[model samples]
Structure formats: C-alpha cells, structure tokens
Target chain A: MCELLGMSANVPTDICFSLTGLVQRGGKTGPHKDGWGIGFYEGKGLRIFHDPEPGIESKIAAFVRKLPIKSEIVISHIRKANRGKVELKNTHPFVREFWGSYWTFAHNGQFKKIKTEPLGDFRPVGTTDSEYAFCWLLGKLKKKFKESPQPESKLFETLEILMTELHQKGVSNILLSDSKHLYTFCSTKLSWITRKSPFGKATLLDADLSIDFRKVTTPGDRVTVIATNPLTSNEEWNLYKPGQFQVWKKGQIVFSNE
Target chain B: MCELLGMSANVPTDICFSLTGLVQRGGKTGPHKDGWGIGFYEGKGLRIFHDPEPGIESKIAAFVRKLPIKSEIVISHIRKANRGKVELKNTHPFVREFWGSYWTFAHNGQFKKIKTEPLGDFRPVGTTDSEYAFCWLLGKLKKKFKESPQPESKLFETLEILMTELHQKGVSNILLSDSKHLYTFCSTKLSWITRKSPFGKATLLDADLSIDFRKVTTPGDRVTVIATNPLTSNEEWNLYKPGQFQVWKKGQIVFSNE
Candidate 1:
C-alpha cells in the first residue's frame, strides 16, 4: 500500500509545513521509500519532479524542499513497487494530454489480471494495471463523446455509469486533476480536511512542527485537503465511506454522489 | 514510498472509473499494497475505508469498485512499507479533527533526521514520519494563530517560509484538505489535469482506457486533477517545478506563488 496527499484552496497557498512532515515517510520516518514524486499547478501549466530513490535521500527531493514554488493546485506521491519494477518508468502520478490540455492521475491500490481493449490513442507506458485502467477510461470517454464537452451534470452521469463498470473489475482508489478542479473516488480507505477562517492550531503526527492557523489565514481563505490518511493530530479528519466519489472546486463541495 | 490520488470538480462527480485503474497499482499493477485506504466527502460528512491487504484482493476494495458512492472531493492511498511494519496501523491517509471540521493528509516523500517540539493537542498513533509532520504542521498553525484563521495570502506566505525551513532538512511533497479547499506543495514532483468544455479524447498512459470528454462533461463543468505523474496517454501532462505550491478552489486557480 502507499500514501496519498492533495489540496484545494480558495486562495493560493503553500503546503510546505504539511508537506515537510509527509515527505519524512518516503524513506526516513515511514517505509514507503521506493521512489517519490510531486506535481504543482501554476496557472494552466504544471511543474513536476520524480525520483526512483527514497525521497529522504534524493537530491532532487532536497532541492524541492528548499524551493517555495507556489500555485493554485498540487498533487504528489511516493512509490512502493508491487507488481511493477521499482524503476522510474513505473512511478505513480502519470500524466497525459487530452483536448489540448494536460491530465494528471495517481493511484493507491492494485488490480489483478484484468484485460481490456486498448484505445488507439491511449496506451500505457508502464506494465501496471493502474495505467491500463487509465487508458481504458480515456478510451471510453473518447468513444462516448467526440467534439464538444458536455455539461457538468451530464458528465457526472456518464462518469457514474463508467465508474460503476470499472469498480466491478478491482480495487480502485484514485485522484484526478486538470489544474482547475479535483475529482476522487474510493474503494477502500480515504480521508479529508478543510481549513477556513477562524483557523485554529494544527499539529503534525510525523514531526514536531506546529502552526497557528490564525496567524496564517484570514476570514476569506478556505482550504480543503484529501489524503489516504490524516496529516494533523489536532484536526478532525473525515473518512470516506466504502465505494464513494466526489469532486471539489475552490474551497467548497461543489458536487458529490455518495 | 506511498502513492496518492485525488479529485476536485465544479460539481459532484464519481471516481469509479479512474479508481479502478488506480487501485490496480496498490498491489496488482504496482507494489504499494501493504495496505489500502480511501476517503470521500458527502455533504459535511466523510466516508472512509481501510484494508490491511492488497486493495485488488481485499473484499473492501471490491465492494468499493462496485459501489456508486460519489462526492465533489475525494482522497485515496495505498501503502508501501518504509517506516513501520506492514499493519493496519501503518496505512496511509491519516485523519483528525479540528475546529469542528475534519482534516486529512497523505504524503509521498521522506524527511531526514528532523526533530521538533511535541504538539500540545496532537499526538501520533503510528510511528511514520508522515504522521509526525502532520502533527508539527498543526501545532505550528495553532501556535501562530491561536484561534482565528488568518487570510489565505497570509497563510500562504507563512507556509512559504515554513516550507523553506523544512526543505533544509529533507524532501517533502504534500497535500492538505479540510473538506472545502485543498492545499498542495511540492519539493520534488507533481502534475495536474483540468477537464471542461471543448473536451476531447484522453488515453491512459498506464492502462488501456480512454474517455471522450464530449460525452461525459458539460461546457459548464470544470475539473482539476493533481498527481505525482500524469494518468492519461493521449493528454499533455504538466510537470511541477521544484519548490512550488498552490491552492485549489471553485474550479479555478485562486492563488499561486510559483
């Protein structure tokens, strides 16, 4: 199994404090230390870095920690090879291009020997079932729609049907983003937190670091975080029900079908 | 290390299809499956599940695959032992409570020998660096603000300074949420995708799946996905620059300091 982390906010915010604690699990504080990766969104563009070494020891990881790049959205992961080899090619949080835009995805579970037709346009670069499923999803979307995008409600309906079909195949806990909004679905375990005005104190469980939300945030700011686990010891982290899915935009819950 | 997956949208959406592909990596397609977990937000509450086995083989994972749970925000993860032994206690995606709200986190990196003060309100049940970091972050927020949350810009600035300090110690890529908005920071790698009107075909890079945006989404629907890597084969995946951070809210980029 692996860990997951994500963020959404009403204003541009930095996740350095929380991220510092999370990274320790890559090789130092946790056992995930197979490989590590991260993604940040700056406007419509995304910046990414990945390494096959434990994040605790990787020089690239060190560089990232020292930098303070900022964006409106971000995603990241560390690898613990299971079916695929522990090479750079098999890292999590795969990226692709669609409709002249970039799409990013990361997974935290596995699928057994499931086979599906390959779309001519989408294919897997690695030999992971996770990648295979991504291609299949793209294929379905392309086959169903051709040119214009559908409305949010219609799209949600279509996705609901497709998600149901895919869930039948195997374990599926996923996070997806296009630099604007975020979407997620859980088959097993997941959790989340939201930070807004009247911010309170938050304490890390991995490190001794602590921050006062009142000192950092204003009444106008709102932030939501989703992860495979809770990052803070003092905050209330909500758990996802089995077989649930959601979509988040800004700092509020814009859509859900759980 | 660990893997992370998340989704945000302008409206509620199901992650069934994408999750199916992602879970395969937890122990089937990849090697993260030391344990699996996921979280979904429905209204103000959250649904969560966890398994101490490969998500592909776990009954819980299977149930999630077939279930139609949905929300506007979601988070998920699979574990790869890096710190503590493989057990239910060492799963990714930790959760907690603060200010009458749930806070969740997941991480994908490692920190070196980092030491901090113990949080007064938060403590770790597991011995993972990821958890420690969560506690430290929350503690700092509490100390800085005491009770009232600051503005988003102020929070972001404070985070920037704190992240820079942590980067000095080791690698850190993280995601934090409060069920409303998300905050992400990358010390190493990260990527994202946004789907909206003028949608097109998307091919998965890992699996043989494709989806046509025209059939599933509306012109009014906008979604963003962030990950350590790209998930599609036919879509352009943007990479995060080193030391970058961002905030996601309302299906748009509200603030970025990249």
Candidate 2:
C-alpha cells in the first residue's frame, strides 16, 4: 500500500501545506518510506519531480514544501514497496502522454493479477503494479476513442467503467488527472475536503503548523483536496465508501459513482 | 537560441559540477533565461526537474546543484524561447516514452516549418518547434520499426537519417538519449569533451569555480560532456561540424558522420 495526495482548485494553488502533513507519513509518522513523487500542472504544462528516497528526507520534497508553485491540479504519492522493487521507476505519480495531454496517475492499494491484461500503445517503463494498471487503463481508453479530446461526459463514463474493471481484480484506490479534470476512485479508503469563500483556520495533523485560509485566499477562491486519509484534524473530510468514484473540475465535483 | 548540456559516462556520474556552470548561463552569464530543465536517466527510470523560472534563480535548480543524483546519461537545457512561449511545457528538454524507454531531447536552435509535419501516435503538449521535431522524428522511427527494442545499429542509422532531414530544413542542433545511447547532431554550434584516466583540473567559463578531476575520480572512470558551447575555459573541447551526427555509449563515441 501507498499514500496519495491530490488538489484541484478554481485558482492556481500550491500544495505545500497539504504536502507537509502527508510527507510526514513517508518515513516519520507512518511506515511508507520506499520513495515518493509529485506532479503539478499549469495549463498544458506538467512539471514532475521524482525522488527514489523517502519524502521526509528528500531535499526536493523540502524544496517543494518551501516553494509555492501555484497550479490548478496536483498529485503526489509516498510509496511502500509491495509488488515492485523500490526504485525510481517504481516511484508513484506515474505519467503517460495521450491525446496531446500528459495524464498522471498514482495508486494506493494492492491489486491481484492486474498485469495479465494487454496494453496497447502505451507501456510501463517501471515494473510496478500501479504503472501496469495505468498503462492498461490508458490503452483501453485510447482504443475506444479513435480521436482524442473526447467529450468530458463520454470520457468520464468510460473511465468509470475502466475503474470498475480494475476494481473487480483487487483494491484500486487511485488519483488520476488529465490536465483538465481529476478523477479519484476509492476501493477502500479515500477522503476529501473542499474549502470555499468562508474558509477558516486549519491545522496539520502530523505537523505543528496551522494556517488561516482567509488570510491568503480571496472570497471567490475555491479549493478541494483529496487523500487516502484526512491530512488535517479540523476540517470536515468526506469519506468515500467502497467502489466510489468522483470527478472534479474547477474545484467542484462534476460527477461521481454514488 | 538556447544552451544545451548533456553527459554520457561509463559509470553513474553526477553532473553537478557541469550543471553549476550551465545554470549560470540561464541568467547570469548568458541571455537564455526564459526557462530551464534537466533529465537524468537511471536505468529505465528518468528523473526530471522542470522550471519555467530561470535556472540561475530557481530554488529547484539550486537544490539539483547540491544533491548529486548520479546517472549514466543526462540532458539539460536553458532556453531563450524563440519558437514558443516561456512556459513549462515549452521548456527543454522534452521527454516522451517510446520503445518502452524514456527518450529525452533538448534543442539549441530554431526551425521554420517544423510544426507543419504530421505527428503520428505522439503529439506535442507544448507549442514548440523542438517538440514538434522530436515527435516527428520519433513517430517516423516508430512507423518503420513496428516492434520496439529495435537493434541499436539499425535504430542509430535510422535516427541519423531522420536528423539529416531536420538539418535540411533549418537549425536542428539537438542532444537526444534513449537510456542506452546519447545521440548528438549539430546544424550550427555544438561541442564535446571527454575525460578519462589522466583527468586534470578544469575551470568553468561562467562561474568562478574549478574542480580537480584527478582528486575525485578513478582511472577506470570515463565521462563525455556535450554542450552548445565550451562550458569550461581550461578544457580542450571538440566542436562538431554542421550536419554531423554522432552516437555515444558508455562515454565512448561508437559512430560518427565524419
């Protein structure tokens, strides 16, 4: 198993606050210490930083904690070796390009016999079950949609079906994004919190830091954060039931499998 | 124009010393300050750090300089943004996965009508002639070789021919690597230097720093550094002629168009 942290916002936002709490679990407060990675998307530009080191000890993760790289979408993960060797290739937050957009995926649960499926054009560079599932999912999507930039609703429906297929095999808790939208599927554990104009103060569960969201954000700002577990103790985190899937855009939940 | 930096080594070597010099060119020493990026290949795992911010001032670049992530192949670029906007996607070096290996490319020159070429299976995530040319090149190779993991010699020959096609159109000075081989092609300015057993001291032209290679390296180590210009003032660098293509593996030149 691994840990995942994701963010979506109406305005460009940084994940330093959320990341600080989650990275603690990477080797400090928790046991996931194999490796970690994160990706930030600015429009069509996707910037990724991967380190085959524990996130708590990684200098790059420390840099990320200090620097406020504002982005509309972000995904991060801290992994514990299970089905794959602990290496840079097996680091979480895997990416593949399709339909002229870079798609990012990070998973958090063990799966059984997922590699038995055939992959199309996209192949996994890493020998991880997480990467294998991503390639398989993307290949299925690409095969169905001969032309890309597909209608959002159509794409979302197809994605849910694909997620269900993976769910049939084993735990498939995942956070994925295609620059424009973020899709999160929960097999067992996933939680989220959305902050809007009337945002108040919040404190990190693992760290001693606290922030008053109102001080930094405007009245029109909206932000949503998702993770395998609640990162903050104060916020009202909405937990997902098993086999739940949700899609987000512009900081709002557009669709879901209720 | 932009500044390109690349390395090939018989052993896993860090490019920190050379990167310290090249990054200075991002703003302090040169005018190519739009953006910068670097990719390091460790086996099949590629770790990349991209910043639309100038490398000289980027905290990420600063972190990269201090942390030594050793690798056998590296490609770094500081861009001036001639053909595309100063953004993350347009920042070199651009990467795409093909033949189950991560391919990295960095360009130092511009092209006129490179975008007019048709892209197959791969598309540019950014609006840049360099990315356009890379997709075009890789797509052609993929078409010819239906199966991946193609013979090294065959792939090298096909790549040389594809590079010639780009050279015919306009400036296509590029540094490309597919984990196993580093392919360099020059349409204008490009140079290289190889250091081996009897390594000597070298001084950077852009910074007031020097390294005595004999103190840090063993006689069994061999390293090849390539750049748009001579990065060090004290070292003897070999300049490539226009339309020349060379392939390097394990820090040794395997083939050339000489």
* Candidate No. with top lDDT: 2
Docking category of candidate 2: high
Query: What TM-scores do the predictions have?
Result: 0.50, 0.98
- Per-residue error at A80 for model 1, in Å? 1.3
Candidate fnat values, all: 0.00, 0.82
In angstroms, the error of model 1 at A24 is 1.7
User: Model 1, chain B: what is the TM-score?
Assistant: 0.91
Q: How would you encode candidate 1's per-residue C-alpha lDDT over A1-258 as one tens digit per residue? A: 667777777788777776776678887778878777777665545555656678788766666665565556767777666767675546667665444344667777777654555554455656667667766776687677763265766656666566556666777777777667777777787888999878999988888888898997879998888888788898999998867878777767766786
* Candidate 1 wrong stretches, greater than 4 Å: B1-258
Local error of candidate 1 at residue B248 (angstroms): 42
**lDDT tens string, model 2, A1-258?**
889999999999988899999999999998889999999999999989888889899888888888899999999999988989988988979888888899999999877898888888888888988899999999999899976644678888999999988888888899999999999999989999999979899999999999999998999999999999999988899998889999999789998978
Query: Where does candidate 2 chain B have its weakest 10-residue lDDT segment?
Result: B146-155
Which residue runs does candidate 2 get wrong by more than 4 Å? none
